[model samples]
Target: MRRTREEAEQTKESIFQAGIELLATKGIHETSMSDIARAAGVSRGAIYWHFENKEALLREIRGRLQSFYKSLVDAAHIDSAPLAESISRAVRKLFKKYRNDAAFRRLQDLNIKISVLYAGKDSFADDIIKTEEADIQLFCEAVEGSPATNSCSPLQMFMIMESLVGGLLIRQYIRQELLSDEDIDAAVAFMVKGFSGIEEKTKTIHQEQ
Candidate 1:
């Protein structure tokens, strides 16, 4: 009997989730279609039916992860809120999401490995760079729309915010530090202060210019 469309989608999701788990634990180089099938509790043929190969599955996983992060960022809608409030909220949500998502945390580890291996030679690096640029642009636009718009150029503030967030993530991942809710709040407050200070400096510079 042929499976229903919903069943097919369910199976696909199962396979994808299983693949993510295996990829996180075993690394992409160590994982095979057979391993994915076994982890997914599906047939090897079923894995093929859903994805052409391991690389295809990896690409799909990357796309799904990217889409998930993009949606989270979009949901913050920082452009409509006051500058300080928006930045605070956005950082809080980001840390909350990172803390809650085991899969995402694992993915970040895997991505770091991939980055080190590919570094300057991989097309994937270009893709990641473009994605980061797009994220920064969205953040800058939101900052520009805030009440603090006159305080700083959107681009300058975004660069500062991005650097702080990136640094925090690296430290968290590398040191395996315990990140509590209070820590997140404090970090966000610090970031907000840094953003405000930079903006004020930029405004002063512009006035002088």
Candidate 2:
């Protein structure tokens, strides 16, 4: 029997979800099409109909993750708020999502594996670099507009923010460290203070000019 379009789409989504879960748990090298099919409760034929191979499935997963990040950035009400407020809100939203979304957390773990394995010839690597560049630009703009960041150039503030977020995530994920509420609050406070210092320096530079 021929499946309806909606049914086809649902099946495709199921396959992708199953692939992601398996990739996260088993690592890409260990996961097979049959494994995915079994987890998804679909035929191996169905998996092939949806994806050419494991690499294709990984590409689709990367594309979906990129789309998700773009949607989050697009929906942020940054333009309506003070620069500091907008940035703070965005950062908070990001960490909150990291804490809550199992899929996101899993994807991140998968990404780390991909980065290590395909270090040289990976399309996902290029995509990650592009994504980071875009994020840095947005952060720079926000920092420049905020009263709390009057001392530093947007680029400097961007790097600082990136370091803080990256460090936190690494510690939380790789070290199996528990991230308590107090930890997040302290981290944010430290970031804000650092930004404020940069702003002061920027003001001094402007005054000297």
The lDDT per prediction is: 0.71, 0.70
Candidate 1 colliding pairs: none
- Candidate 1: residue 3 lDDT (0-100): 100
Model 2, range 113-170, lDDT digits (tens) per residue?
A: 6767777865757766765677556545544555455555667665666677767877
TM-score of each: 0.75, 0.76
CA lDDT, candidate 1, residue 2: 98
Q: TM-score for candidate 2, please give it.
A: 0.76
Q: What TM value does model 1 have?
A: 0.75
Q: For each candidate, how many residue pairs have backbone atoms clashing (under 3 Å)?
A: 0, 5
Where is the poorest 10-residue window by lDDT in model 1? 67-76
Q: In model 2, where is the ten-residue run with the lowest total lDDT?
A: 68-77
Candidate 1: give its CA RMSD in angstroms. Answer: 3.5
Superposed on all Cα atoms, model 2 deviates from the true structure by an RMSD in Å of 3.5
